[model samples]
Target chain A: MKLPLLFTDELRGFYKSKLMLILWIGLPIIALLFRFAQTTSTGQDIPFTVISTIVISSLAGTLSSVMLAVSIINEKNRNVYTLFLIRPLKRRELLLAKFLSVYICVTIASLLAVFVGMTTDYITTGMLSTKLIDNTAQSLVTSLSMLAVSCAAGVLIGVASPSVMVGAILVIYGGNQISVIPLMPTILNITYATLFTTTTTLLTCSLLLIAAIGLFERKQF
Target chain B: MSPRNFRNQFVVLREVTKKYGGLTALKKISFEIGEGEIFGYIGPNGAGKTTTMKILVGLLTDFEGEVYIGGFQVPKQKSEVHKLLGYLPQSVGFQEWRTVDHALKTFGKLSGLTETEIEKRITEVLDLLALSEVRHKKIAQLSGGMTQKVGLGQAILHNPKLLILDEPLNGLDPLSRYQFKEVLLKLSKGGTTILFSSHILSDVQDVADRIGIINRGQIKQVGTLNELKEHLAEQRTVEVLLTYATDKWREFQNIKHVKSVEQPSVGRILVNIEKGSDPDDVMNDLAQLIVKQKIRIRGINLLSPSLDDIYQKYVQEGESI
Candidate 1:
C-alpha cells in the first residue's frame, strides 16, 4: 500500500521535473532528426528504427541516471527522506519508488522516440518491412533491458555517493557503462539476445537495487 | 521514581544511550511526557536533542534504551508507533518541483488518509499555516519561513497523537514565530502531545508545559517552568535603584548575610546574598544600612531567576563537567 503511494508520489514529482520535460519533447525531436538524416543520405543500410532505439536509449538512459543520482544525493543531503521514513513507509520503498518512476518515464520517452522513428520509416518507405520490424523489436527489448540496468545502477550510485557532484560524476563515468555489459552477450552473438538480455537485466538490476536498498536502510538520515 | 510509573505518560525513555564511533551522542538519559502535554527538549548544539528525537521517531535505531511511544516500543513497533506519531525533522527539504498543495497531498496520502480526508486536511493545513495563498506556488519559490511552515503543515496534516519537532522554529521570522507558537498552543489544547526541541529559551518557556534540559547528551533536568526555577531559588540576587548616582549602596556589602555587592550601573546596584540566608532578613539589613548611611533609595526588590539564568547555569555546568 505504502509502496504504491510513494511510487505515485515519486511518479508525480518526476513527471513535473525539467528532466522529464526534456525527455518527453527532446527525445522524439532527436528521433525525427535521425530519420531525416537517414532519408537524405544515399545508400544508407541501417534502419532509422534501430538507430533511434540505441540513440534514444543511450541518451535517455544516461540523462535519467544522472538526474536520478543527483536528485537522490541532493535530497539525502537535505534530509528529505526523514519525513517519509517517519511515516509507515519503508526505506526500500523510497528507493524502489524512485527507480520505478525514473525507469517508467525513460521507457516511455524511449518508446515515443522509437515509435516516431518507425512511423517515419513506414511513411518514407511506403511499407513496413518484416526485417525492419524484427530489428526494431530486438533493439527495443535490448534497449529497455539496458535502461533497467542503468536506472538501477543510477540508484546504487545515488545511495552510495556522499554528494551530488560525486554522484553525478559516478553516474556519468561508471553508471552508464553498466548498460553496455548486458548488451555485450548479444553484441557477441554468443547467446539468444532476448533470453540473455532479460536474464542479465533481472539479475544485475536486482543486485544493484538490493545493494542500494541495503545502503539506504543503513543510512543515518 | 521510574518514568514508567507516571500516569498517562504518552512517551517514555529509560536509560537511553546512543554513541557514534567514539563520541556518545546521548548518555543514559531518561524522561517522560504525559498525554497532551507540551514537552520542550532544550539543549545547546551537539547536545543530543536531535538524536533523542530521532530515536523516539524510530530514525535512529542503533541505541541502548527502552523507548515507548503511546504504549509501542520504538524501532521495534515503529510502524505501529508511526501511525500515531507526526514528526518534523530539524532540517528537511521537500522536492523543489512540488507545489505546496502537491507536497501536502502526497504526505497526506502516505499517512493513509483517504482521498476526501486528504483534500480536507490539505485545505485545513494550508489555512492553519497561512499557506493558502501559496498553495499553487512551488516549494523552491517560497521563502525560508514559508518553507518551515510547510514542514510543520505536513507534520500535522494527519493529526497524529504525538508530534516530535526538532528546531521547528529555526528559520521563522518574528511574526511567523508568534503564529507558529500560537498554532502549537492550539494543537496542544486540542489534546495533541508535542515534544519540540529548541535552543531558544523564551520560546520553550512560553509553550512547554514541561521542559527538559539536555546537555552533554544527558538529561540535566526535567520539570515544569516554575519547578526548574525553584531549583536555583536559593541563589538569589537583590536589585537596588538609588535616587542618585552615588556609591553609598556599596555599604550594604558589609551588612549581615550579604555575600557581595556590585554596581552594574551608576544608579543600580545588584546585591548577592548568601545561599542559606533569609532574603527577607537581608533586605531588612540593606534597608537599615541605607537609612544609616543617609542614602536616599528609590526602590529595592528581590530578583527571581529567569529561564535564561536556569538554562545558562545548567548548560555551563554541563560544559564544565
Candidate 2:
C-alpha cells in the first residue's frame, strides 16, 4: 500500500520537534559527560565515541518508543483520526509514516552522537585500532536495528492499547522487556553476534509493524 | 468521466441500513441528491442524521448500505468515493499544536492534492473563507467561529464534487452562520451537491431546495419546504389566528371540526382540527363570530404551519395513535 501522503507533513513536524531535539543533542553531550566524569574519577580515559554510541543508542530506543506511543495515543483521544477518515487516507499508511519518522529521527540522533564523539576521541587518542573501528560500525548497525524495533513496538502498543496510560505502561514495561533483551543477550555468542542480533531485531520490528498497521486499519475511528 | 454529469447525479444512498449491535440506527433509509441542490436532512437527536452522513463520507461502513457517490459504491469504491467527497464531521478536532497552514497542508495532501497544488489550494480556500491572516495561528488561538471556518475550509480544500456537512451550523454565532450559509450556497452554485443535516428548522427552511425530516430513525417527511408545509397542513389540521382573544373563544369547543382550543400564549390561540375539518367553514365561522363580538381586532389570518408546528402535530398524533 502507498504510504499515506497526508502524514508526511505531520512526520516532518514531529521529527523536528523539541523532544527529538533534546534526544539529538543531549545524547552526545551525555557521552561527553560520561568520558569527562570517567577521566576525573578513574584517571583512565575511556573511548568517548564508544560510550557515546552506547548511551545515545539506548536513549534513542527508549525515547522513540515513548514518543510513538504518546503521539498516537494523544491523537487518537483527540478524535484526530476523524479528520482523516473522511478523506482518502489509508490507516496503514498513517501508522507506517509515524513509525518511520520517529525511527529515522532516533537513528539520526544516535548516529550524530557516535560520529562526533568518535571524531573527538580519534583526535585525542591520535590512533584507532582496526578491530575497534569494525566493532564500532557493527555496534552502530545493531543499535539502529534495535531502534527500529523499538519504533515498531511503539506503533504496536499505540494500535493495540486503547489509551495513552495503558500504552505507556505497555511500552515501558511490556515492549522494552522483549525488545531490549535482544540488545543485552544472556546467551554467549562467539562470532557474527551483531549480525544475528540485527537480523532478529529487524524481523521482530517488521512483524510488529505489520501487526500494528493491520490493527490500525481495522480501527473504527 | 465528465465532471458535470458526474456532479449532477451524486450521493445516491440505496437501501441503507445501519445496525449497532442489537439496535438499528437507520433502517433501509435511501435518498438521492443532485448537483446545485442544498438537501437538508433534519431530525431530532439520535435520529440517525449523523449515522447517514457518516455512511456517505465513508466513516461508518459497518452499515448494510450501498452509498454511491458519483456512481461509486461507498464500501467497494470508498477510495474513489472519498476522492470526490468532502465531509465535515459533527465534532472533529485538529491537532492544537499545528498552525492553520500546517493543518490545511496535511488535509490537502490527504485529499489527494499535489504538494505545490496543495499550497495554492490552501491559499485559495483561506482567501475564499477570509482566513488568510489567521493561517499562521495555532488552532488553540482561534475562536469557535474561526475554527469552524477552518474545519469547513479543510473539507472543501480539494474542491470535491460532493460535500457532506453534519451539523455544520451548530455552535456557530449568527454572523458566522450567515457566512457559512453563503459559503455553502456558493459551493452549491458551483455544481457541488451538498448533503447537510440540521435539527434547527428555520435555518434549513431558508436555503434547502429539498428537505428530508427524519424522526426516530425513520424519515417522517420529505419534500420541498412548501410541499412539506402543505402536506402537514392537509393531515387533519388547520391553524386559525383569532382577531381578538375573548372568553367567547371558549365557544370554539362547541364547533364539531374544532377538536381542541389551546391558548398557546397570551395573544395566540391554536384551533386544532379533527380528522376531516373543512378549513373554509372553520375560518368563515371564526371571522363571523369575531366581527359579531365587536372585539377590537388586528386581523384574522390563515397561517401555514411551520416545521416546529408540524413536528408537534405529528409527534402528538403519532403518540396518541
Candidate 3:
C-alpha cells in the first residue's frame, strides 16, 4: 500500500518538475543541433544513433545525478524521511519508491529525447529506412538502460552523502566512469550492446537500491 | 471502531534506549500515556526529545526495548498504528515546487482519504488556517508561518486518533499561535490524543493536559501543570512589594527556609527560600511577621511557580532520573 502510494506521489512530483521538463526538451534539442552540425560538416557515414547514445548518456547522467542529489540532500536537511516513516512506511519501501519514481521518469524522458533526436535526424536526411528506425529504437533502449545504471549510482550517492554538491559530483562524474563496469577487463566481452545495457543497468540499479536502503534505514533522522 | 476499544492503550514505552555510536541518545526510559490525554514533552536542544518522538512514531526502530501505540506493539503493528497516527515533524520538505492544493491532495490520498473527502477537507483546512487565498501558491512561495500551517493542515487532514507534533507552533505569528491553540483545543474536545514536544514553556503549558520534562534523554517529570506545580512546591518562593522600604522590620531573618531577603527593586524585595521548602509556609511565616511588625501597607503572596520556573527546576537542575 505504502510503496504504491509513495511511488505515485513521487512520480507526480518528479514529472511536473522544471528540471525534468528541461531535459525532456532541451537535451534532445541540443542533440539534434549537434547531429545537424556534424552531418553538415563530415557528410560521410556518422550514425545519428551513435550520437543519440552519446547525448542521452551524458544528459541522463547529469539530470539523474542532480535531480537525485538535490532532493535527497534537501530531504535529509529538512528531515522529510521522518514524516514518511511515521506513516506505516518502511525505510526500504521509501527508498525503493523514490528510486522507482526517478528511474521511471528518467526512462520516459530519455526515450522522448531519443525519439525527438531520431526524428530530427531522419527529417534532415529524408532517407528513411526501417532498418535505421529499428537500430535507432535499439540504441534508444540501450542508452536509457545505461542511464538507469547512472540513476542507480545517483541513488547510492544521494543516500550515503550529507551534501547535494558532493552527491551530485559523485553520481554524475563517478557514475559515468563506474558504469563502464561491463566494458572493463573484457570480462563481459562488451558483446551485444543490448545485452550489456540490460544486464549492467539492472544489476547496477539493484545494488544501488540495496545500499541506499541500508544507509537510509540507519540514518539519524 | 470504538475509541473505548483503545482506551486502555495510550502509549507504552518499555526500556527504550537509543544509542548513536558512542553517545547515548536516550537511556532506558519507560512510561505510558493514557488515551485522550495531551502529553507535552519538553527538553533542551539535543536532549533526545526528537529521538523519543521519532521512536513513538516508528521512525526510529533500531533502538532497544519496545513501544506500544494503542496497545499494539510498534515494531510489530506499526502499520496499524500509522493508520491511527497523525504526525507533524519538526522540519519537513514538501518537494516545494507544487501548488499547495497538489501537495495536500497527494498527502490526503496517501493518508487514505477518499478523493471526495480529500477535496472537502482540503478546502476546509485551507479556509480554517486562513490559507484559502494562497491555495494555488507553490510551497516555495509560502512564508514560514504559512508553510508551517500547511504542514499542520496535512497532518490533521486525515483525522487520526493520535496526533504527534514535534514543535508544531515553531513559526506561527502571535495570531496564528492563538488560532492553532484554538484548533488544538477543538481537536482535544473531539477526543484526539496529542503528544507534542517543544522547548517553549508557555505553549506547552497552554495546550498540553500534561507535560513531560526530559533532559539528556531521561524523563525527569511528567504530569499536569497543577501536579507539576505541586511537586515543585518546595522550590516555590514568595515576593513582596512594600509601600515603604524601611517600614517593615527584619523579622523574616528568623523564619525557617527563608534563605535571603533583598530589596532588589525600590519598595520590592524577593524572599528566597531554602531548598525543599514550601511557599505556603513562607507566606504563613511572613504573615506572622507582618502582624508582629505591623508592616506598612504592601503586597505579599507566594509566587506559584510558572512553567518556566518548573522547567528550569527540572532541565537546568539536571536531576538524575
Give a tens-digit lDDT track for model 2, residues B1-321.
012222465667777888888998888887788766788888778888998887777767687757778888887788888888887878768876778998898788777788999989999999988899999998868987788788899899999888888898988888778888888888987888898988777788766788887766667777777777778776344444556556767766676677777777764666777655677787778767667766555555566778788666655553554
Model 1's TM-score against the true structure: 0.94
Pairs in steric clash, model 1: none
Model 2 CA deviation exceeding 4 Å by range: A1-8, A37-45, A184-187, B1-9, B114-120, B234-246, B250-256, B262-269, B292-296, B311-321
Give the number of the best model, judged by DockQ. 1
lDDT of candidates 1 onward, in order: 0.88, 0.77, 0.78
Docking class of 3: medium
Show where candidate 3 strays beyond 4 Å: A40-45, A181-197, B1-9, B235-238, B252-262, B269-292, B319-321
lDDT of 2: 0.77
Candidate number with greatest lDDT: 1
| Better TM-score candidate (1, 2) | 1
Per-prediction DockQ: 0.80, 0.61, 0.61
C-alpha RMSD by candidate, in order: 2.9, 3.9, 3.8
Q: Judge candidate 1 against the unseen true structure and give its global Cα lDDT, from 0 to 1.
A: 0.88
TM of chain B, each = 0.94, 0.84, 0.90
Model 1 regions more than 4 Å off: A35-43, B1-6, B245-251, B288-295
Q: List the pairs of residues colliding in candidate 2.
A: none
Candidate 1 per-residue lDDT over residues B1-321, each given as its tens digit: 112123599999999999999999998999999988889999899999999999999989999989999999998998999999999988868988899988888888888999999999999988998999999999999998899899999999999999999999998888999999999999987989999988788998889888899999999989988888778788779999989888677678898888999987788899999988899999988888888898987899999888899899999998898
